[model samples]
Each structure stands twice: as C-alpha cells, then as structure tokens.
Target chain A: MVRIQDLPRKNFLMPGNAACPGCPETMGLRYVGMALGENAVLVIPASCSSVIQGIYPRSGIGMPILNIVFAAAAAAASGLKAALEIRGLKDAQVVAWAGDGGTGDIGFQALSGAAERNEDIIYICVDNEAYMNTGIQRSSLTPYGAWTTTTWTGKKEHKKDVPLTLIAHRVPYVATASVGFPTDFIDKLRKASKIRGFKYIHLHAPCPVGWRFDPAKTAEVAKLAVQTGLWILYEYENGKFRISPLSRPYRDKSKRKPLVEYIRLQGRFRHLKKSDIAVLEKYVDEMWEFYTKLEEIYK
Target chain B: MEEDHLVLPLSRPAPGAMGKTGTWRNYKPVIDQGKCIKCLLCWLYCPEATIIRHEDNSVSVDYEYCKGCGICANECPVKAIEMVPEVQGGA
Candidate 1:
C-alpha cells in the first residue's frame, strides 16, 4: 500500500475550491498534480473542473490552467503543446482535463483527431458517468440503467467503450484509473508524463451532488464499481492489452452484490426497476467475460 | 506453459467477501460534546440506531454501522454533531 507520508509534500490545489463535498475529480487532480509537478500545463474545458478552479485571480490550482470550450479541449491542448515546442520549451508536459460529456460526447471529434495524429499530450476524461456540470444529465458514457436527469426512468444504453475507441487509433498509451485507488492513478500519470505520444487516462470520478449520494461514501462507491466488474481497469500500451490483476475472484451473478447496492446509493438510479437492474447485471457480466477473453487471447 | 497453468490457484475467496468491507460507504460518526446540548437529536435520526444513550442522557455515536451522512450534524439544534473526515471515506 502507498503511504501518504512517503509521497511528495508539494500541494498543487488550494482549499475553498467550488467542487461539492465529495468531488472525486479533486482527488484525481491531486494525484496527477503530484506526478507532473509544476512543469505541467493543464487544459480544461467548461465543466465541473472549470467551476472548481473558480474565476481568474482566485483559482484553486497552483499551476497554470487554460479554460476552453467544452468541445475544444483536446484540439486546444494539442495547439498549446505545439506552441510550447516551437518556443524551445519541450520539457513541460501538456495535459487536457475534460469531463465525460466533453470527452465521450461533444469533444470526441477533436480527441479523435489528436489521437489519430499521435499528438504529444495527455488527455484525461474525469468521468462521473454523465454531464454533471450542466446537470445530472445523461451522456454517451452514462452506464446502462443509470438514472440521470435526461434519463428520468434510467439510461437504456450501455456506456460507450471509450478506452477501446481510443485504442483503435493505436495511440502509444491508454488506461483507466479511479480516485479510490490513488496510487494506481498517480503511477499511471507518472508513466503518461514520460511517454512521447498520444495518451489517455479515463478517470472514474464520483460526483456526490450529481449522484445524490452521501458525500462521505464517494470512495466507497468507486471501489464498489471496480469490485463489481462494472468498471474494469485496463491499459493498452502500443496495442498490447494489460489488465489490472483481479483484486479478487470474479463476481458471478450468484455471488455478486445486488445491483441495487450500487444503484440505491445514487439518487440518479432511484427510478430503476428490478428488470432494469437484471439487464444491467447481464451487461456487466458480458463485459467482464469479454475483457477476460481479451486477456487470454492476447496472452 | 501447461505446467505453469497448474501453479495458479483453482479458486479464490468471493469478491465481496475478500475485502469484507463492503463498499466504501463505511464511515464512523463523531459528536462534539462541547457543542452538544444532550438534545438526543442524533439518537432519533440515526438510521442504524447505533447511537448509545448514556445514564446522563448524553449521546455517543457508534462506528460499526454509521454511514456518516452528516445529517445528524445538520439537524442538530445545538450544532453538536460533526462529521469527522475518515482516512479513506470520501472520494
């Protein structure tokens, strides 16, 4: 286990930020910031992060943050990176931090362009599973049967395979991390900072207000997500697939926690029916099987 | 390679049982006695009934099943209950 005392003492974020009581995105930023330090340029879109950082002259981030439109984060980060290189500043790492709505939905075109071209920048999607900044609305990345403002009854579609979609571009690196596992997240950021091509980190951030969960249970929900196999952590390095070790045995239907355990904590999924949970469980099982197969075939 | 496959364990503990600590929602509640007026608001609001009533009528929060919603603190008329940050509780 990674100890907080052994980590660097430099603090990149200040208190009094605008994030809700248990915003997991802040933890994600804390880990990434520790890994990259002051030599990093962050590009954020108009999302929860933008609000969290507050207006200019009162921003929470100690490092430089460039605020841009929702759909232009990736493209803008690429431009900033190239500009830095042209100015003979190749040491600084350029990073794009965006929300699920920005990366998985609106900014996908720009992200695809940058990844296809193998731009030298890190693009992180801090996914709370929906367009939370605007409202608790459904986005392309919202999981199946999840409740959202847009999906009042519950989402009918499965979350888009965002990591796989990026891997299709054959980028140098792509991985998934969560604030619940800070050491893993920090390690991924350190690795991404050293890599020289397009890199993507899909971070699972829990939004307490948006999810209607108790502020204190955010990390618990994040851990449940991975333990339930509803959110698997994997990375594709140069077309090679590597999954995090199964922290425990596979959770088959008979042994799995009731889907309601994962759903009831968040008010968003309060409207889901028993049949909806069953459908979601089936999908989770199928996805888990598919991922295990990938590991076996690739090995 | 075939022999190596045999080295792997045949089965492991159930996923939910392996950690035993259910989801990350496990939290302990704290009460600020200095701010408390012995109003018993926390005792009445505790969903798990984990609050203990002392002979003096003072309330003590139990950590075993407390979800730590801070509702008790918010609802406390005397501002006595406070949500103490657990080491690994929040996101």
Candidate 2:
C-alpha cells in the first residue's frame, strides 16, 4: 500500500540525459532510484541505459554506476558486492541492471552463474524485448509475432520464460513488475532490498520508438500489456507464489482484455494477420496455464 | 598508492549532462494551476526528472531541461497539464 505522496522526493536521476523524450527505461529508473535510494551501486551492461546515463566525464545519474561490457553485468555486480564487503561497506547494495539482450541472450550465462551461486545482489532485467539501442534487433525475450529489423515479417519464437528459469534455481526472491504500475514495482523493489541472496526482478518496459507507439502512450501501452494477459505480474518468494493485486483480477479468463487490444496499439504487430494473432492468443493462454499449474503445485 | 594520486577516468554526476535537453522538445507542457490537484503524477512519470515537486506539495516544471514529451499531460488524471507547441524565433 505505497502511496504516491509517500514516495521519496530525492531523485537519483538528474534532469537531462540521452534518453528519448518518453523513454520507458527512464520511467522505470525513476522509481528504481526512489525505491533503492542512494546506497546502491548500479552495474549496467551494453544497453539503452548505458547510453541514457550520458557521455564520459559527466554522468546524468546522481548515484554511482559502473558501465560494463555486454555480457558482464551480473559478474561485475557479484565482484562489486564482494569488494564492498571487503571494504566493510556491508550495508551497500549492488544492483545489476541490464536490458533483455543482456539478460536473456548475451549475459545469460553470467546471470545464471550468479543466480546458481546465490550471489548477494539484485539483478534487474528491464525487458523492453529487443536490442533497441542497436536499432531494433531481435532478442530471445521478444514476443512472438512482433516485427523487428532482423525479423522483417514477425518473430516466430515465443518469449523466453526467464523468470521461470530463475525460479528453477530457487532464488530467495523473484518478481515480475510493469512500468504501468509504479507502486507495485516500488513495493517489489523494497521487498527485494530487504531479502538476502539472489533477487531477480523482471521489469516490463514498453519502448515507444522500437515498439512503434506514440510517446505519450507509454504508460497506457504498459497497462494494456497487463490487462490483456500479455504480461502477468506476480512474485515468488521462499518457495511461495502469489499473483500481484493489480493483475489478480485478470486471472479470471472473462476479466482479461482481448490480446488484439494489446497488439493493435503497436506498429510492430500491425503486420500480424488474423492467423498470427490466433497463435499469439494461444501462446498467452499457455503461459497463464503454466503459471496456474505452478501456483497449484507450490501451494 | 595514495587515493589522491590515483588518476581514474571518472565522470562526475552533473545535471543536464547531455546539454539542455529542453531544446530538443517541439512541444512544451503548460500546467493549468486551477485544475492541478497536487497529486504530483506528472513529477512521478517524467522521464527527464524535470518536474519539480515543492515543499508545499505543489509542482512546477523546470523548463530548462524538460524534453516536453507530453507524458505529463497524457498521464494527468485531471487533465491539468497541457502540451503547447513551442514557437521558435518569435513566430
């Protein structure tokens, strides 16, 4: 029950950076700063965030951030945490923030190793679903039937279930959050901060430029992602699974919005034919079914 | 190896690090003070962190660095913020 007014007024992200006008990465980073405060060190890999922090000799963000190569964010974070402990800075938190390309594809091995070892770090994968900074290349997290520069028609493979993969490792905490629901995201961040061991938060951020939507519609697009069942918000902690309140209503099949409503808003899915949309709809159902089974088994 | 003598390639944190991004905006957001409920939703959603939340809980836009993305106007629950086109060269 985090209220809007109760949020900290201290902004970690400064006024002007290199992000686009209505970039979703910045939208999420604002809350990330609010929730984590000044004690965290962010390790960013090659992604939009790397550029968003601005050029050398001056950083756009207020806190300490280590910009690393494409496949080393988690590895760097693990080392950073160990170094902080050696310096007797036990209270400091090390956060690894990377895009989908870095998390699901490029840096998956490092991330997996860190998770398996139960590293004391918070790994946040801001999944915008593609290599957007590199001009819209496809990543494993890219949803099926969405067009990228490489996938001229549409991506044939469904999105990778990275959260489920993390769950298999039985980490201390794992949650899926959306930029549309900032308070829910904030609550998740706070909860993760309090917990020890590996924590992974998958933040669904819709890209206005790469996703081909109006800049002003960033929040709306994110909200639609949840309402349509394209993205489910939930948290898994200490061998327990529960759906977040914002998305609980959509668990009822009748309450969920049509998948087409979510797809029609983005130009990347404009080329999706009726048959392709049916495939997407089926995919969403399968995902929901898998989650429901997990809940039942865990319960 | 004294810390002071260690020449590290460090970048200090600075505001407007990418220059005054307000210049990139084609549209400027105008807040209608009367309609503002002081919810600070605009400040929360702003990507550039240009919206200023005051001590009294009232809000104002820092035009110097605001990119005028219209997100404030769009996310305004009461339509308190309006996006006005920037008139260049005294129109």
Candidate 3:
C-alpha cells in the first residue's frame, strides 16, 4: 500500500535536465524507477527519454542505463537478459524504455519479435502520443484530430491500439498505466518486474512542451484523459482482460468532463474545428464502447 | 465607450449530447466582461460547446456541458477569461 502522500521522497533523477516542465515521461520514469528500485538495468532508445536521462557521467537516473539505437530497444533488452542469464546473474530486472515513435513505429518489429519469443524482460513505452524528442512529429499513437508538426492540420488516423497488439502476441502480462495514477502505475511496474516472461506496460505520459500545455497541469491533464475515456486504464494477463475499476463508465454524465476540455488543454490540438472535434468525440465514444464490451465479455 | 468586440462563432450543442454534467465542477471560466473583446474564442474551442449565448449576445458557460478542461482559458487571446476552481465537485 504505497500512500500517495507517503511516497518515498528520495530523488533518483536530478533536476536541471532537458525534460520540459511537468513532463509526464519524467514522472513515469521516476515512479517506475522507484518501483523497480536500484536492482534494475534500463535499456533506452533514441528518443526524448534518452535526453531526459542525460549523457553518461551526469545521468539523471540512479540505475545503469544502456542507451541503444532508435529501434532496437526491445532486442537490446532481450540480449542483455540472455547475457545476464549466461552469467548466472538473474537477480537484476532488465527494462526497455522507449517512446511511442520508437515502439509503435520504428521499433514495432523488434518489440513484436521479443514478445513472440516470450523473452524475460519488462518493456515500457512512454507514449506522449507523438515523437516529442525530435520536435513534435506525429507517430502512430497520435490521436486523431490532434495537431502536430507533421500533422499541422490534425492527424487523420486514429491512435494505434498498442496494448491489443501486444495481447495478440499473448504475452504473460500487458497493462496500460498513466503517471496521473501513480499508485496504480507503481503497482503495475512492481508486478511487471517480478514476472519472468515478456511484460508490456504502456504509459500515457503527458508532454508539456510538445502538447503546448502548462507545466503544472501535466498530472491534471493525464487524470482528465482517463476520466474522459480518451485513455483507458486496464490490463491483459494471460489472455484475460482485467479492466481497471478506475475506468468505470461515467454514470453521472454531469461528473464526466467533456473530451474537448482534455483536447483544449493541449496546444497540439489548438487548430481543431467543430467537425474535427465531432469526429474525435465519436471516435472516443466508439473506443470506450468497444473497451466496455471487452470488459463485459471477459468478465 | 463601446469595447472592441471579437465575435468567435460558437458551436451550437446538439440535443442529447453525452458528457459529465454538474454545476460545472472542475473549471469555472470567468469572463471579465470589461476586457472581453467578446472574441468568443472560448466559445469556438469549447470541447463541450458549453458556452451559452444570451438574447443580448453575451456568452456564458452552460455548466451542463462544461468539463472544466480549461482550454478556453488558455486560448483566450486577450486573457479575458480566467479558469477559477468550481466551488464544488472536482476530483
């Protein structure tokens, strides 16, 4: 029972790093690091995350980070795990942290290969919904109707369902988490660390700079994301779907915030029109309805 | 003196829209009518289309549709609108 207020105050990552203010990726990394503790080796890719950790000799995180190429994070982590097994040193947890671009786009092949092999490692994709490190370019995870450098008019396609993609692989554990829900995220990380086979954690990390939102509202924005049904918090364990109770439908419509509010808070979606917003709302409704049906069927 | 008015077209809400409805719990967008160029940017970008127009053509938030996401406040060009906390019901 990690009390939100009583969470350990020890700071593993130092300040003055490159991360923008109220960066969701930084928060997720911090909590995940805390959950895994010092007995972990992080395999990073060429994304905003790599910069957040800083360069060697002055890294932000306390653990040993193995910075790999843009698309080989999953493969590198698997290799490290195999090497550790060969050395008979299986005590430490090996984690591969990648951005949405690295995981959903360029790195998808390597990641799918690792999961298909059931490699023993934990993989977390800090999805800011776009390629933030390389200047707000659009990725497969960028939600439709949202603006980005690549999609100044708004992304025409819907966000790719990465969790369900992993579920197709039928891995041992796959969970969706957000820094907005720290306890839930930490719990998932802890559980993922202990699991033997491939585990996947998809975190919706808010990017203040890329999203063009205030730094202080990072957590608040993420909370609204889940509350609005734009981002669902759930897990699939051994082919069974366990939708987090936090994702319960908005029975009291009054209590449910509009998806527009969530969209407006971020600068990325500033240019959306009435028709665009309508399309996004419909997409959100359809996705939420689909997720609910999945929950009912699996329940 | 008449104020310079910027009338941003507000999207009319459809009947039977599904959204969180309360007395506008999370955000309360306060318009400083004095500074309002009446640009209506708040009305245009409202995700919920919660802004209501009076017969006199003044704009206000329809708490029924407002989710308090604060995009209106952020996009207000003249800083005429401020997002204050709703006195009741926010997570």
Error of 1 at B20 (Å): 39
Task: Score candidate 1 by TM-score against the native.
Answer: 0.76
**Which stretches in model 2 have alpha-carbon errors above 4 Å?**
B1-7, B88-91
TM-score of chain A for the candidates in order shown: 0.94, 0.99, 0.95
Instruction: Please provide, for model 2 over B1-59, each residue's C-alpha lDDT reduced to its tens digit, 9 standing for 90 to 100.
Output: 58879878788778888999999888889989899999988888888888899997788
lDDT-superior candidate, 1 or 2: 2
Q: Candidate 1 overall Cα lDDT vs. reference?
A: 0.73
Q: Pick the candidate with the highest DockQ.
A: 2
Q: What is the C-alpha RMSD of each candidate to the true structure, in Å?
A: 15.8, 1.8, 16.9
Better of 2 and 3 by TM-score: 2
lDDT of 1 by residue, A1-299 (tens): 34433455455655444555456776677677778888878999888888766544456666677889989999999999999999999998999999998998999999999999899999999999888878788999988877787887777888898988997888999999876667777778888888999999999887788888887567678777777777788877876777865323553545555656777788877877788888888888888778777766655
Give the range where candidate 2 chain A is weakest over 10 consecutive residues by summed lDDT.
A54-63
Worst 10 residues of 1 chain A by lDDT: A246-255
Best by lDDT: 2
Model 3 Cα lDDT, one tens digit per residue, A204-250: 88877788887647777888898887788998886678778676655
With candidate 3 superimposed using the best TM-score fit, by how many Å does residue A209's alpha carbon deviate from the native? 1.0
| Candidate 3 C-alpha error for residue B52, in Å | 45
Q: What is candidate 1's CAPRI-style docking category based on DockQ?
A: incorrect
